[model samples]
Target: MRTLNVSISDIEYNKFGLKGEQLTFTDFVDMVSKELTRQKLNKCLQLADKYSLSKITMEEITNEVKAVRQDAKNRN
Candidate 1:
């Protein structure tokens, strides 16, 4: 097992609502992972909107995905 150290100002820590809270390393890692995933998803959504892909319907997306999968399976 290893230990990690982090420093946060009192004001900033409380501002982020972490004051008096206890979090294990695992919890910290999970929080960081979730935040990263959220950021990536938001970026992808922004890109989709920028490229006008946001107008695509769910059924169209699903069919396109299925077609690609079937094509790949046939190649194998």
Candidate 2:
């Protein structure tokens, strides 16, 4: 329900696929939010791969989660 005036370079405009496209404020916000989420997920995946966490077994991961939860519960 508000208006914001943002400026971007020609390259960025095209990269966002907004060149010659008419998008509503909500649509633009949604697009940008999705892109941000995707980037964060990709970064996490890269770090997990780098640390060899990507190959972690489900049982090990579950046990780790349970231990963390128990530790948090004890703190509370």
Candidate 3:
């Protein structure tokens, strides 16, 4: 494990809406990861709205997953 001094601007801090609060290394990492995920999700939302993206149900996916697992088991 290691630690290093890093700097962040107030604008970037406010962009994440997390200011003037105590945060550990893991907390900072979690915050950054969630922010990145949120940005990617927003882009996906934009594309979905533009093209009217299709969605799949859990039951539909479950059958595919079962088939894949069975195939892998047969391979073993």
Off by over 4 Å in 1: 9-16
| Residue 50 accuracy (lDDT) in model 1 | 100
Per-residue lDDT of 73 in model 2: 100
Tens digits of per-residue lDDT for model 3 on 30-74? Answer: 988998999999998888678755364678679889999999999
Residue 58, candidate 2: Cα error in Å is 1.8
Which pairs clash (backbone N, Cα, C closer than 3 Å) in model 1?
none
**Model 2, span 1-76: residue lDDT tens:** 6767778888888778785646688888898998899999999999999999999999999999999999999999
Q: Judged by lDDT relative to the true structure, which candidate is superior, 1 or 3?
A: 1
Model 3 lowest lDDT segment of ten: 48-57
The residue-by-residue lDDT of candidate 1 on 1-76, one tens digit each, is 6777778789857654674556788878886787789889999999999999999999999999999999999999
lDDT of each: 0.84, 0.89, 0.81
| lDDT comparing candidate 2 with the true structure | 0.89
C-alpha positional error of residue 76 in candidate 2 after TM-score superposition, expressed in Å? 3.6
Q: When superposed on Cα atoms, how far off is each prediction in RMSD? A: 2.6, 2.5, 4.2
Best by lDDT: 2
Compared with the true structure, model 1 gives a TM-score of 0.75
